[model samples]
Target: MTRVLRAGVAGAGVFGGYHANKYKQASDIDFVGIYDLDIERAQTAATAHGVAAFDDLDAFLSSIDVLTIATPAFAHAAVALAALEKGIHVYTEKPLAVTSRDGEAMVAMAAEKGLVLACGHQERAVFEAMGLYDVPEKPLRLEAVRNGTASTRNLDVSVVLDLMIHDLDLAISLAGCEAGGLQATGRRREDEGYSAVGGDEVNAEVDFENGMKAVFRASRMAAERERTMRIVYPSGTVFIDLLNRKFENGTPFALNSDFAEADIARDPLGTSVFRFLDTVLGVRDRPLCTGAEALQALELGFAIDEDVAF
Candidate 1:
């Protein structure tokens, strides 16, 4: 039997708690506990899950060999570095870090320590399960839209980091190549004040070395929710309405035709967690999302933010 791993989660917010629940339900995990700036919140989650609650970050770091960081974007690098320095495996939520330099540093630290450093680009799992990578040919163009109603939740970073990073990571995964050059433009929501901290809408066009191109649109100001992607290949088109949980695999080279109605919920986060465990347990050689890949996405996101007209 595989040995159980002791695990801890930093941050007690929605995503942190969600990660905690995943650890609790996994048979290979001995869920150690949680930590948060608000000790009360940590205790509440700890009590509910029957795990230890730590008020001190160092103590929490000492308690577990594996950690999931669901903290804010700006704090991801610091926490991940600390965990890696302590020889702890880390699975952090997306954007890796607010700056590319920090993302690079985190990646370097993990490499130095030989720790499993994974990022929560969970959306990649669903796309992979759907076989988005097996297109009949290299995509001439790829398009994506991920928009939703405004929320105060993740305003610490731009929409490019808060929301667009998902699609950007997916864009890289589907293209299966490094992006070359990109041009971008954006504006904040009209209703917000002039000093608003982050953008509400953003757009970018990325060029691949092989002459393939991809365009992305992300907005947090939409009245409705939508998450979709359209990949154009020589054979045909693959259209995915991620919000509606449906996709039309229009290629003549059919893969999974009934994917939309396939009863299984598209729970990529679960898949991401399992992949992290697999890496830590030595069952897999690499995580689903590596630090280098997350860093690449962060670098591209910063490039996309450069032309923001707002």
Candidate 2:
């Protein structure tokens, strides 16, 4: 009989809370326990989800079949490395790690341990509209803008890691090429009052080995939120408005329409989490975003950071 997977969530923060709730509600798995440095927060989350709360990391680590690390970006490497070393499967929040080196190490360790490592880039699961279709043939030029009102979460990382990485992942998935070169420029927010700890808004252009070009813009200090992408291919153009959950395809289908009121059958986030669980149960060979694929996105983001003129 297939054993029920016991999943433990580390970190009782926003994303961690979401994972805990999903595990609790999922029928295929057991919500083993939740752990956090802050015992009160962990207890609160566990009680809300009807799961156990642990203050000790060692005990928590020894008890679960899988570990979901939703900690801050800077702590991802350390927590993931520890879990992988212990032969535990991992599902972590996006921007896998702060640096390419850490990201590579995490992937290597998971492979060495014969365990699955999934990154939470949930947007990839959005099936609303034609979001799943790949960019036809070669995308000569691509433009993506992901901006959001200031949020205190992930302030430790620049907007490139926090926001732009999403579009970078999508661009890499569509371009299907390793980044050949990248150039970027960024500026810190002028109004200190907007954020006590200022962060940079970055614009980057990346050249891919397959002769594709991509332009990306991301800002955490925007007055309003927007997530949009435009891909221009040889045949036609495709645009996705992630914020509005709408898409326009001008290629094979000459449809100039919107899906703002479309009845999405399932929640994309739920789909992503269930897919990860499917991977854990050996129902899927690999996740939609593999560890290596996520590493590539992180590497591209890091390259842009390095090339940024400051």
Candidate 3:
């Protein structure tokens, strides 16, 4: 029988709870419990999942072979570093860290320890299902829009980190090269109650080293949820409606509709979790989303947030 790896969560809140449930459903892993600053919430979440809650961070870290850090973006680096130092495989939610420096540290430690480190950039799975990765020609231009109604979730950072980062990751992946630089403008927040130091609505134009260009617009104060992308190549264009979970290939390449229901349904978190576990267990050749990749995306996002002046 394949050994079931012990898995635990670092936060008992929104994404943490979601991840806990995923761990329960995944057959190769045992849902151990959660560790959080709020002991009560952790205990409650643990009870709901039929697992033990930990008030003691060390105890929680010691008990699990894999720790998924679904804490706030700012806290990711610290929690990831602790778990990585303890030789535990780590997977963190997106926008790896508030700062590129912290993100780089997490990636470095994972490499040093030879432990699997993955990021929760789930949208890549959507593209994978669309066979977007197999598009023959490099994109000359790309456009992305990711908007969602105001929510109290992930308010620790601006809309760029919370919402736009997803599209930014995708743009970079499709561009398939390092970014040269970018130009951006953003609003702090129209919703007074949800504003942060990091702003909420942002639009950026990125120039890639390989001559591909991308324009990304993300807003958390949107009236309706939207997630869409368009990639332009010499031959034709590819348009993907992420929210609708389908794509239209204006190009000649025969893109497959052979994707599974879950993939097409846009619940890539399950796929992301599966990939993370596979990487940790050495069953997968490589991570679908790596710490370093997330770090690069974070760096670009910060640049957009801070470098508005050309």
**Steric overlap count per candidate:** 0, 0, 0
- For candidate 3, the clash count comes to 0
RMSD of 1: 1.8
Instruction: For each candidate in the order shown, give its overall lDDT on alpha carbons.
Output: 0.84, 0.81, 0.85
lDDT for each residue of candidate 2 in 170-199, tens digit (9 for 90 to 100): 888877779898878887776656553224
TM-score: which is higher, 1 or 2?
1
RMSD of 2: 2.5
Question: How well is each residue in 230-271 modelled by candidate 3, as lDDT tens digits?
Answer: 899999988888777677779998876655464533568888
TM-scores vs. true structure, each candidate: 0.95, 0.92, 0.95
lDDT of 3 at 93: 94
Worst 10 residues of 1 by lDDT: 257-266
Query: Where does model 1 exceed 4 Å of error?
Result: 190-196, 260-265
